[model samples]
Target: MHRFYLPPDECLKDPPRLSERESHHALNVLRVRPRDRVVVLNGAGDELLCEVLNAERRALTLRIVQKNAIPPLPYQVTLVQAVARGKAMELIVQKATELGAHRIVPILSERTVAQVDAEAVPDKVEKWVASTVEALKQCGSAWLPRVEAPLTAQAFLARGDRFDLTFIASLQNEARHPREHFESFRSERERSPESVCVWVGPEGDFTPAEINAVRAAGALPITLGPLVLRSETAAIYSLSVINYELQSKRGQNGHLK
Candidate 1:
C-alpha cells in the first residue's frame, strides 16, 4: 500500500489532509484519486488506513477508515554520528530511521570535514529531517527518528546524556567487537540494554583527544573489523551490528520484541 506522512498534530483533523509537498506527490506523481485506499503515518506509531476523499492540486483530503498503533521497539537506539561530507549525512539519517534508531545527533568532530556554520545548522537539520520522513514513508515505519541540530562533539558530550550501553567506533588497540559487549552485558544483566547509543566518527575519524574524551564519558570502543570503512559505511555498519547483536531473540513471527 502507498504511504504518506502527516505530522502528529495534524493527523487527528476531521479530515486529515496531506501537506503541499505530499499532496503534489499523491495527485501529480502517483495520480491518486478519491476513494483510493492508502496508509498515512503520523510518525508517532499511528498508522491510519485512509481513503482519499478529495484530491486537488495542492491538497489531499483523507478519510481515515482504520487506525492502528504500533508499539515502539522495546529498546531505543541513538546514533551520535559525525557529520559526513557531501550527501552522506542524509543517507545516514535515512538508514538510521530504517534501522529503528530513535534519535540521531549529528556532531562536528575535530576531524570532521563537513563543517556547518552555526547559521546553516537549522537548514541542515531540516534537510536531514526530510530525509528521515522520506525513509519512514518508504519503509513503512511508524516511528520517525529525531534529527538534531549539528553541534560540536565536546558540547554534545558536555550535556551528559546517559545511555544504558554506549559505543564509539574506534581503531584503538583495546577496542572490542560489538558481539563481545553484547555478550558481556547479557551475561551480567541477563538482558539487552534498554537504551543504547553509538558514536561514529567522520571521514578521518575522531582525533586522539576526542577519543579520550568520549572514553572518559563511558563510551566503550567497538571495532568494526580489520578494514577501515568510510564514515558513511561506518555509520551503517555500526547500526547493523547493534541491530543484530543487541536485539533479544525474535518472536515466532520473526519480529523483535
Candidate 2:
C-alpha cells in the first residue's frame, strides 16, 4: 500500500479531502484511481486506511475505512548532530528516520565546516523536513520525526536538562565504551525516560572546551569503538545502538504486544 502524510486537520470524522501535494502524487505520480486503497499518516502516529472515492486532476477524495493509533516509541531518541559537509547530513537524516530516531538537531561546533546562517537555517530545515517525509514513505514509518534548526554548541548544551540520558560520541580514550554507558542508563530504564539525546561531533571532533562544557551539562562521553567514524556515520551508528537496545528490552519483556 502507498503511504502518504497529511495534516491532522485533514482527517475528518468522515472522509476528508487530500492535500494538493498528495493529490498530485496520487493522480500523476502513483496514478492511483478511484476505489484504490491508500494509507495516510497524520504525522502524529495516527494512521488512516482509506479508499479513493474520487480522483481529479488537482484533488483526490478519500473515504476512511480504518483508523489506527500507532503509539510512539517507548524510548524517544534524539540525534544532536554536528553539521557535516555536502549531502552527508541528508544521508544521516534518511537513515536515522528509518532506524526510528524521534528528532534530529543540528549543532554547530568549533570544528564544524558547514555553517547555516540565521537566514539559511529555515531553508536548511525545510530540506531536512522534506527528507524526513520521503524517508517515512520509503521506510513505511507511521510517524514523522522533527528536524530542528541548527544551533551552536553552547546553545545545544544548554538544553541538556530535557533529556534523561544524554551522551556524546567521543574519540578520546578516556571515553567509556557505549555498551557500558548504555548499561548504566539501562539500570534506570524502568523509569522510562520521555526522551534521550545523543550528540555527535563534526569531522574534527569537539574542541576540548566544548567537550568539557557538554560533560558539565551531564552528557556522558561514550566511544563507538577504537576506530573513528565520520560525523554522519557516528550519528546513525549511535542511534542504531539505542534503538536496538530499547527494542530488545521491549521484546524480552513482551512490551511490544
**What are the TM-scores, per candidate, against the unseen true structure?**
0.96, 0.90
Candidate 2 lDDT score at position 115: 83
Candidate 1 minimal-lDDT segment of 10 residues? 248-257
Show the lowest summed lDDT stretch of 10 residues, model 2: 248-257
Local error of candidate 2 at 169, Å? 0.7
What lDDT does each candidate get? 0.90, 0.82
lDDT tens digits, residue span 8-68, model 2: 8878645687878889998998989999999988878888999999998777888999999
Global CA lDDT of candidate 1, please? 0.90
